[model samples]
Target: MRFQWLLIIPFFCLLTACSSSQVHWRDISSNAVQASAAEEPLSLCRELYKDEAQIYQCEVEMSALLRARQQCEKDTDPSYCVLMAEYTWRHYKDHVLEDSPDIKQAGNYPVMCGYKENQITPCSLTK
Candidate 1:
């Protein structure tokens, strides 16, 4: 029984060691995603509209995009930031008129943390 317990302890220890690899996976994948996710929103007005009326219309839509850009900056997650920014811009262009719906200032910011030694460290995990 004593020998069996000794073996069992090492087996359990190995299990924990293997689980630590999950952390590396998370760090790499999230970082990779974050790196790949960076993209600026498509300009609401591809080129400057020469006419005053056209420029004003373009600016209105641009406001939504600007708000989306601001919201994207607040998140640490790359994919989510892209999704929210793109969604707000697309939604505003498709549904809302001018600046009716402020989709930019929505959604909660979630935090992801890592451990060192025995302490928890707060981190920006994006989305």
Candidate 2:
């Protein structure tokens, strides 16, 4: 009986050690904001695989990205279209930042994805 108890204790300890260690998204985002408030550098370790979309600005950007990707899904090669659209968006964001540093935007909506326009001009040259 004592031997069985010893075996179970070690087995439980091993199970606990092997548990998944996924970080909470809120922890990442909340910490970034908190760090900013404290005038501290972000405490997150990217090595832990934090989701970029968790950041407030990133969350905003993701809305546009997801919208663009969803619209692109109608294309014959949806996945490819989405990939290209994302690439274009990143470049477009960089372009806008270079041209108008004051513009706070989450990339222009993908016109190539058949999106006519967002009321928010974002970084598009049309504005």
RMSD value for candidate 2: 13.0
Check candidate 2 and list the clashing pairs. Answer: none
Find the candidate with the highest TM-score and give its number: 2
For each of the candidates, the C-alpha root-mean-square deviation to the true structure, in angstroms, is 18.5, 13.0
Per-residue lDDT of 21-43 in model 2, one digit per residue for the tens? 53322334334434335432233
Off by over 4 Å in 2: 1-54, 98-108, 111-127
Off by over 4 Å in 1: 1-47, 78-80, 96-127
Query: lDDT for each of the candidates?
Result: 0.41, 0.46
Per-residue alpha-carbon lDDT of candidate 1 for residues 1-127, written as tens digits (9 for 90 to 100): 7899999999999999865422111222333333234453223233444455544444444443343344445444534554445544455445754543332332222222222223223233332
- Model 2 earns a TM-score of 0.38
Candidate 2: worst 10 consecutive residues by lDDT?
118-127
By lDDT, the best candidate is 2
